[model samples]
Target: MNHYNLSSDLELVSMLKDGDLTAFTEIHRRYYGVLYSHAYKRLPDSEEVKDILQELFICIWNNRETINIGSNLPAYLYTSVRNRILNIFKHQKIESDYITSFLHFAHQNEPLADEPFRIKELVAIVEAEVSLLPPQMRLIFEMSRNSYLSHQEIADKLNISSLTVRKQINNSLKILRVKLGTHFFMLFF
Candidate 1:
């Protein structure tokens, strides 16, 4: 395992603020496993673990704007993650999922073997439309929809702040709404 890096968090964070994705990715990769372990130790079930990690990273990035630190990154990340996890564990019951779209997909008839062509065509169309967006907006827009990852996961993977991810998605959806509003509204049936 790569050990906790000795590079000061201040310097690393400076690199992060400059839109350095590589530096940010490294920091996330280094700490993700440890942070998950910290969360899992406090929370029951492996399922909620992913969501907790997402929230933790999102919170960290959101708070990073005004934060300054001299502490080791690992200790700070681990303790912060643990305290957050314990807090959640103490307060909430894990409610059953009420969404049934997942069940709909699970029971749907399997597509024909070559039916993937339809997906490819749809992807091409979406990509073409997304490409017309402003640059950063375009990247975030597609990353949110094309990948199976959640918004926070996309933010972590792209090393952009989660706020940026949410903003981008909001912007993209609004544009899409304007472009397809009547069409979209007609689909509720």
Candidate 2:
């Protein structure tokens, strides 16, 4: 029988600190699924969830020399995952606020027929701005917004991770926000 199979997390962690590859592999085998599931619950994007988990493990490995988990490894993992999720949410909120701000500006300043006309203009602006995105980001953005595909759907179709699909979409939005600036409100109100 493998002693590692019966070893406590603290023991495995100590071994990991000593640069034990087998111990690290064992830890990965033990917790990767649990961590992945936890991340998926908070983030619907599978690719993002995978990335988050992968990053967590990679961080652990890279920092193994200095890593310290005082007996509660599961809690440590959960906390790390939670923090990453919070950061992702914070970024999403910022992007959402940009959209909200644009809407408010349009509501306050634009008129009846002007609203529709402005929408058309905004569509044009978005198209032009989207064209400016890197090819992959633009493709993902269009797949999501124009083709109305879900992240998982896009990932499957593109043979990429859903996380990559989401990141590209977010990047595209950020670029649009910056390029369109206050003018976005004039286009989409």
Candidate 3:
């Protein structure tokens, strides 16, 4: 182990390529702290930094036969850490952008969940006000608006003059407008 530690990086790489576990352990001991510090500078999370280093070392040991540091193991390790950190940042950005886009789409395209209840409430208020009108006027107003009958049509159905139907409908509208206010009147009628 002391001899492996004293050997140069090139000697360690050669021994590692032959599957020398001691050489691999020496390499890990020498490079882990430097690589961890390099990664932590860019990514402050302790667990994430540890995972990256762990994965990197595992990959090195698994692929030692084909690994090609070529006498610059420190540079290779640093580059690997940098690339991993950049990949993490890219993944986080994509997740952030997706969340932002989803929120925007929901806000623009989705109606409030309570919209039907609100419409029902508004209709109820308008109906309550309309029910307070004179009986004959309420019938005429309902025929003209709800049944989509013209004044002449309503007059023909009710055996009244078109002018009388028009007057009754107008009076009903005036009463509703006063009761419901101009805002609610316009929305319903």
TM-score of each: 0.41, 0.49, 0.48
lDDT of 2 by residue, 61-141 (tens): 999999777676766776787789878877884465445666898889755476446545533443444444455744543
Task: Give me the runs in candidate 1 sitting further than 4 Å from their true place.
Answer: 1-10, 93-189
What TM-score does model 2 achieve against the real structure? 0.49
Which candidate comes out best when scored by TM-score?
2
**Which digits, one per residue and each the tens of the lDDT, describe model 3 over residues 127-189?**
445444554644543552335556687677667798887676566446544654654345435
Clashing pairs in 2: 47-163, 48-163
Worst 10 residues of 1 by lDDT: 1-10
**Candidate 1, residues 1-189: lDDT per residue as tens digits?**
011122345456676666554445546644555455545655656878888778767766766655553344544565566566657655666652322444676688574467446545433443444444454544544442344566687777666788887786666445545664564343346
Error of 1 at 74 (Å): 1.5
Best by lDDT: 2
What value does the lDDT take at residue 113 in candidate 1? Answer: 60
Which pairs of residues have clashing backbones in candidate 3? Answer: none
lDDT of each: 0.55, 0.66, 0.65
Candidate with more favorable, higher lDDT: 1 or 2: 2
